[model samples]
Target: MSATVGSALAWWARTQPEQTAIVVDGESLDYQGYEAWSSRVAVHLRDAGIVPGDRVGLLAENSLPWSAMALGIIKAGAVLVPLNSRFKPAELRKVADDAGLARVIASDAVVAVAREAAGMGAPYEVTAFADVVGLRDAEPDPATDAFRVDREPTDPIAVLFTSGSTGRSKGVVLTNQSLLSIVFEASLTEEGFRQGSTSLLVLPLAFTPGLVWGVLMTTVLGGTIVIEKDLVPGRAVRLMEEHRVQAVFGVPLIFDAFSRTPEFAEADLSSLRTAIVGGAAVPVPLLEAYAAKGVTLRQIYGMTEAGGVATATLRHEAKDHPATCGYGSIFTELKIVDADGQEVGPDEEGEILIKGPGVTPGYWGDPETTAEVITADGWLRSGDIGRKDADGRIAFADRLKDLIITGGINVSPIEIERVLMGLDGVAEVSVIPAKDEKFGETPAAIITPSSPDLTAADVVAHCEQQLSDYKVPRYVVLREDPLPRLPSGKIAKPQIKQDYADVHVDFDKVR
Candidate 1:
């Protein structure tokens, strides 16, 4: 057994076979159970001719099967490409084609969607692993006898999709050692990630926090993870209470939804000792609310290329600097750099550059784009705006990409602007982030109409032709003035964003 997840699982199964490894919808699978199930899946993959280094697709909603299927893919020594369950045919096709998947293992819940996506010209095969959890009954001679392919640490394990600044999804190639490095670091940390801890994960298992931090990190520590397929506010609260979850992870929106629930005040959340929140800045009120319950909700700032965690609010600074992402982790080195790439002094805002063991090697199959983001000397240009305080704590300023993260998903405004500009009467269009009660923030399009008659309906209709639904602006404002520009000739997004703050458009009234 090597220093991989598969080896870790084997160690755990041998040491504590009866320990509860995963729980979903009231059913629990012990370490031995999931190990045996994943073994059978590995054997099934081998029988189907999936060789080492081949990329296999794992498409399913968060569930016990998803966990097993992912482990099986790893054990088979094949690369895993975890597709987002919410993707439509076009997005699915894009990922499948990009990954050049050897096969896709979709659970029964989304087997039909997978089949439809496969038929839409994704070469290779799609296996409908009916009753994925029932794979344990495949009746292998013994769990110990299951075949395990030794994988090199340098071998690529997963290609997680990220919405790049260029609009298309960039498959971040993470090596086995890259992931293990972070997981191994978490195991030794005193940040509430410990053995026998029960973690509740509500976010999607496709990327960052969900897979690397939530599932993989938890498994490495031999902890039990509670997985919920979809996050219905009430159900999520009850699920956490029912499981007596020790640690919880999600974005700020997840916490906001829980706070909105009437039961939040009295939800018996005493079991929640450590609350990890990320994605967006934590509102002071939200932090106070959790603090009142004796739960210190720490904020983390990271990206897909940083192995899911870069800087996290240290335990001592958790309550004081509730807004800042925090000091850099021992495994990652963080710095603020000026436009010319020189290191900036304290409290000076500049691009955040990170370099460490957690930083990814590069993006999959695209050396040109990878070279642009990752410097030749091994530093990753985060494309995010931030600054460091005198105390060495990192605080987020803004995004260099001008990205709108609505509902915790990145929406490229440039993609939408291109579509809106394509329509008649649209001279110039700038998409800015607007505050939303549900999603925290959504896209708002400010247009300078060129033609005599240009309707908001026309703009939205044109956007519908190209962009995804979430990327479409919920509010459209037609302006007679030119869009503000900086001295550098770039669109002054801060001004547009500030002006749009007070003006809220009702989406329901929009045509």
Candidate 2:
């Protein structure tokens, strides 16, 4: 019953040595070999002077070595801090300073950036990931008992940085118990996500969903994971067909890209039973398209603080309540509350509060901010507005900070966004608040159109038919390029709001 991740890996290695543990770029690692390889890496880390509780930074792209080194760091009793590979040196230095990493291991592709970041942050040694793997291979493995470090269920396992789509990123601390709880919940709730199942991982491993479910927990479940570095839709389709991937967890854009690929039409996706999409709302058309291909695209909802997923639409509800994020997850308790902390009735919009073993203890080294979010007795304030239907399904409204208060009327941007997304030619839509002289703040839709001729007038005409007068976007900005996205693939709403803060729509010319 030990919740430590290392124990899980060891158990799998003993029980199913020949099982395929991970596949990256067509190369596979069996569970037995994976165990020994991770053990060697852990022995090397200890020899290199890494101690228990030390925060070790990992900066690398998605690869087999990156995955092995992560388990190695955790097995060595160190706190793993996975850094974003896309971060600039300045951004890297900022997180390096915050985490106060004792050492950083970078892959060959990013050694230079990691070195520069180390130089700028608090003094910490930097080592190449390739070097660690090489050294471990050349040296003989230490006794299995030699690297054993007693770890408690509450001991910190990793520090994951939030995507910061709305603001500055914070390091969310997760313990072994927290992650294990989620793994248990997911295995029980996600149909077809079980032992021996093959999963396709396209999201960056640094993201919570990718690391928690795709890598760490998948290993615990004795499942095989196909890793894709660059998200080529055709390539992803091929991998799924080849590996018979059953559980696919990705954002909406990823699935959308797969649907556009020619390979997707003929690909044998019958093996795909748990196609879960989170990070953003799953378009109904996209869901229907996947269903036509004999795949049910379920919408999942959760945050870093909740581990990975707190709720996900079940297969039975996917057709009728595609908009809902489904009921609370197995181990998670969800409740809707008003601004004054009073519980809201069903069908009432309020902040969603989650309490569960999967929820994080607190943010790393930021008790003040942690106190502001997590209540004393337990519940974590989700900072998301939603409504629970009488059927117990939760419908996401919008981020509390993204709500538009136009003419003193609270408007949910997600409502407008869901409407805009339904229009033909609109690929992605983010509804933000645009300053208006008459209404104070009007809803503005920033659209990334798939069709070349998609115009603002067309968007307006489409919204007018579906939305109420105030709910209709007053301004529409069409961008030729894709909208800015976080690592989790969610639109950067704060950035969009900041970028268009000065945008104005003539009230006299408005509807």
TM-score of each: 0.79, 0.96
Candidate 1, residue 375: how far the Cα is off, in Å: 2.1
The count of residue-pair clashes in candidate 2 stands at 0
The residue pairs found clashing in candidate 1 are none
Residue pairs with clashing backbones, model 2? none
What lDDT would candidate 2 get against the real structure?
A: 0.85
Off by over 4 Å in 1: 131-133, 143-145, 163-166, 403-511
lDDT of 2 by residue, 1-511 (tens): 3568888788888899899988888888888777777777787778889999999999998998877788888999999999999988899898888887898889988989998877885778888976776643454454742244548889888999898976978899988888888878777886567877789999898889778988897888988999998889999999999999998888899999999999999898999978988878888889889999999999888899998788889898898898899888777888899999998999999999999999999988899989999999899999999999997899888889888999999998888888888888998889888888889888888889999988888888988899889989877788888898887878888787778777673322345
Candidate 1, 1-511: lDDT as tens digits? 4888888888888899999999888788998887788888888888889999999998888887788888888889898898877667677888888888888898787777777888888467888877445677765567433667868888888888874433346889887789878876665654567777888887777667678877777777788998877778888888778888888877666787887787777788888867877655676777888888778888887888888778788867788887687778877889999999999999988999988887888888889989999998999998888899998899876677687889999776655775675577976677888778888778888888888699888877888878888878888888898776432123566677767766565344243
* lDDT of predicted model 1: 0.79
C-alpha lDDT values of all predictions: 0.79, 0.85
